[model samples]
Target chain A: MDCTIVKIGGSIIDSPEQLQRFLQDFASISGAKILVHGGGVMASRLQKALGQQPVMVDGRRVTDEQALKAVVMVYAGWCGKNIVAGLQSLGCSAIGVSGADADLIRAVRRAPVPVDYGYVGDITPESINTDFLTLLLRAGITPVFCAVTHDGCGQLLNTNADTVASCLAAALAQTGHISLTYCFEKDGVLYDKDDDSSVIPEISSGMYRSLRSEGRIAAGMIPKLDNAFAALRNGVSEITVTHARSLLSGKGTKIIL
Target chain B: MDCTIVKIGGSIIDSPEQLQRFLQDFASISGAKILVHGGGVMASRLQKALGQQPVMVDGRRVTDEQALKAVVMVYAGWCGKNIVAGLQSLGCSAIGVSGADADLIRAVRRAPVPVDYGYVGDITPESINTDFLTLLLRAGITPVFCAVTHDGCGQLLNTNADTVASCLAAALAQTGHISLTYCFEKDGVLYDKDDDSSVIPEISSGMYRSLRSEGRIAAGMIPKLDNAFAALRNGVSEITVTHARSLLSGKGTKIIL
Candidate 1:
């Protein structure tokens, strides 16, 4: 993959020292790149501080207007800006962007179904403005994206980070060969759920299904893995699941079809 | 100015109805444009909401670590993102940015003299990335900037809105015929301080000095005009001081050499 789109999970963002170390490694990767990041843990904490208990329905946190604002503040404001600044300090030029920026990504508000997700956005790869993003990338600016999108009619919508990464890798595949990575606290897709060092070196889609049948993979990992596989199908060259610290060395699980 | 750089002061931002009107008019103006905005009032209020009383000395707010975070959250997160979204609603494509984004503007932290204004940044026209800005503008993306800058070494600093506007207008003058506008609650620099309709239609630099000597201008207007005059002298073709409602019709005080 000539250009990498890395999705750094919320766990990496919880510790400042760890986050700085991760950025130091992320900046060392050579090529035009993009960063899409998660905000759940931080957003939840900030929401509590602002006197609102986060509302969770069916194991998913519902995004109300207040919650949306809180998350936008944390992801786009704290994480996105500081990550770009950290990259700058490391001699890698980066720019922070929300989906509303330059109309880079336009999403449709999710329709209320079995439950109302409330201000959640759903995006397709076709909705992304690859032409404008290519201009930014060719100019040598690494676009650091937050988990916020716009409805084109001017409303901010909360989006899942993994989905953002998947859509971007698919949309921007033509810019260069695309490598999509999901970095979190774990080493990779683990062979033993309880052991941090039990990294499974490789997992094909059929293997992923068998592991799911055996109930080995965590429930939360399913959607993320689904996103990774979708990205691969849509033309991302490869998918890597690793802890942020090991990104530069390429030590992690590689997903295959 | 072929490209207009407009600074919306905190006074105008204080009122939601007024801000919306201003943005509508700002979006209606034809040609490339950039928006610089002030945030001390909103940031202070948010800081107070978060249980931190703002520290103020001699008309200036001290930007301690907490205050800096407060301002960044308010300006870059809430204000900047929403402004771009608001402009999008008006059919203008705008992207929000901090100085750290794309290395658009670099600044140096202010040194302690009589008072340590901790975390405040001072910038010059030379520090702005005119080339990058021109690219964004040429691509028809309006840049909405917050009062946040970076020290290039990973520190984000709080810069004055007027300074951000002045520097941008001066630096971007080469892009086209430049007209810089400062929009606030008041109509313009008023001849009679109590009367909003008593705006001084035109104030030459010599006239500004004479008005200063005569003690007719308000103290706050002095610095804003100083910035306006500086932009005019730095190759910006014109400077307008007006209320947001008068933005397109060009009804306001015009500063001259």
Candidate 2:
């Protein structure tokens, strides 16, 4: 049951060289199933280029009708295929997926009552069917997931990559392989982004709340940590957060109970 | 009252030079609202390269979970943006859209009754909102649409470009605009493919029906004719089927009731 879910963040995807190297490394890992989660950095860049300043409320991009379409074009088309091509060039079979496919990732539209963030959504766990993932893995195909989900009402919405990665990890956790998240900028679970030396090698569930109270882990890292802890508590065997290059070098922070 | 829905077929889009010429001509037209429809020739080619044979039932391609993602990557990512870039070079503000955004084109997933077709679907016209198009046109923005629709139930399905163009034409008919479908191969609507001189200058509903009965329209042309008539019946004042270069030259079969 050697199956691992790896999330490739959008920040790293911006560099073609980095992506190519990652694909080369990814192909060498044999006997393991993989799932990918991508972000909308490229799409977001497009919005800025088009003079539509992105409005973000509580970590979610405010996806008005126009922004939603732009993101869809960039995420599903640009980012997804480039990765698939990378994997293909390495002779690995890779399949790109969005939540709309087979209702792969059903989401509840977060109607930002306080802010009016038009089309952003949240993942609804009950809607995910891991059996599809099982089938893909059994077929020895790598499923590359994009950070987009359907509200189950015909409309597709942009979702957070961390949450997507978490859901996929939890979905495949029963197979004994751990969840690994790769980001470009950060070292392994730093106690403070400003201080690299404060990096924590490992943290238990008990320390997370205090760390947050002390405001140690914040920004995008907070939700990622929260999702990781939730997955671990929900029966996921293990989870790790780290830099892409460090993953193979055993230099990441492992989350524990 | 001067809006026009212009459809650029997949064949023209298959060649970069042809596509560039179309974009240049598209920029020359003024005082009319333009809507673009693109095909999935490149995406379909990539799909075959990936070893996932397209599953088609009836004449429509079934977008399975994997293929749906592939199309998004190919259509919106590669083809849509590239087209928009070309149009932009000619000073047109082009926007790319898929069925998932704002429920642009809702669909109902047909049961996989056609044995080889895995996940094909049909459109739900009532779900398309022309408000976005109206807004873009009012702002002098050209809206480029891809032939994909959401099934209102969290599924993205492959639809025919002709159908999408017809629907858009019908949706925009209130403004008394014409719909023009551009193919790259021939100068005009040919009565017979073998003899270019057998070009049909005009086609009425009855003539089109007789052509169909005589088996003159086969395979791909069947949908084009069906959609052309469907647009006229629904509300479009006029519809033209011809070469993209002839769009401005008025060298095509004009279909009217």
Candidate 3:
């Protein structure tokens, strides 16, 4: 009867071992509905092997034709299925869907600006399908997601996984489910990136913004915080910023609106 | 002393026969630099044979984890080499690159909103290497690009071939190149989708947007317009939206700023 939206970041969930450990934890929440978000780190790895360099502006990927293809392989093939298999190993039924299916996320193509960034899109919230998540949850299936979305014809866009989790959690917040974000690193939400010991017990939407403004949060943490705030604004309750293991103890920075 | 960027859409360039025709034409272009964009309509057919319904949204295919793997096999192994071999047969030096090979297009990950879209990215133009393109052109080699790009840390996004062509053209536009977007269907841009004979002479940015807003342009035309506008904005000298055969006659719609 309960549901939890969880986002697994690329940094923490890097290897099979980490993923396996997370799956073991996930299996315990059998009766509870779980939604997942992952990808990015692995995508970076595979993008390198293929020899295409990635470009980013304002934290989001440019996702040109080439990078977009790489994303499809890394997110869908490598990240999404691996997590699904990991969850399946632990006896959880998992189905992976991208933004293109069911018009789940309708995004407007963002034109190249500031620097001719190509084929990027912005989320159109009105077009999101909250009901689909409910249907999946009602059916008791673990909906695992990768960061690739479609522009409604056949072109795939490379979106951030953390942002996807946050957006989904926000859309499905009305269902009264608990949302949690998981990265491989430290305890949960921390006051600083370098000092793992400075784990912040909680983060307010305003305080999180200030932290970002002060240049305290960088790398992958900014999007997580921004998405968490967005989710909170959209009515998700009890968001936890933490690692997978800490979920059991309910330990991590509690995200508050 | 002349450059042409050719974008092969999923529908028309999908078949071997269609691809061969395009390659033969490309081989015939004398003293002109060419860049080719390709996708795996064939692979999607193969994937469908395996029981996975291809997920699409707003003209973009959702290249999730599984689809990504299939595409890698299809694009790099099948489509990329297939085109390369065709070019070779025509006595042209051709080299294939996905987003992974040259750090060609850097991107960041995109997040899912309605669904767990897997592994899509946004393009970061700052990271695109025009030098690689220039070097290839200088060497008198035709660069055949698979519609896959990289996220700076090694992830790929399944991007639109039209968008890729636009990106490449925009990047190399200053060298006085003409961007030619070719698909199979008709010989030129149409005034109506139903009438293949209704060839529109030219479309300005405003006119294109108006038509799209009025629902006059949808399906395959959307990416073409999106990329055309992108190419114009990125400083491409001119863009010709037409079919493969119309290239010689300059019969397609000339997209002007």
Scored by lDDT, the top model is 1
Given candidate 2, what's the lDDT at residue A144? 76
Return whichever of 1 and 3 wins on lDDT: 1
Clashing pairs in 1: B1-B177, B1-B178, B1-B179, B2-B177
- The candidates' DockQ values read 0.77, 0.09, 0.02
Against the reference, the lDDT scores of all candidates come to 0.87, 0.68, 0.65
Q: Against the true structure, whose DockQ is highest?
A: 1
Model 1 chain B: weakest 10-residue lDDT segment is B55-64
lDDT of 2 by residue, A1-257 (tens): 56666777777788877777766777677765565656567777767755678777667688897687667666767676556646655666565666664356768888667778787778744556576556556656677777766665446677887788777777666666665554555777778868876778898888888888898885778878888887786667767787765656567788998
Best by TM-score: 1
Q: Look at candidate 2 and give me any clashing residue pairs.
A: A77-B73
What candidate 1 gets wrong by more than 4 Å, as runs, is none
lDDT (tens digit, per residue) of candidate 1 on B1-257: 27888999876777778889889989988889999998778888878878899998755679999888888888898788888888988899999999999898899999988899999998988989988898889889999999899999999888888889999999988667888999887889999898878999999999999989999999778878888888888889889999878888888999999
Q: After superposition, how far is residue B239 of candidate 1 from its true place, in Å?
A: 0.2
**Interface RMSD for every prediction, one decimal?**
0.9, 14.3, 15.5
Compared with the true structure, what per-residue lDDT tens digits does model 2 show for residues B68-106? Answer: 766765676556655654564566655556655434566
Off by over 4 Å in 3: B1-257
Residue B238, model 2: Cα distance from true site in angstroms: 30
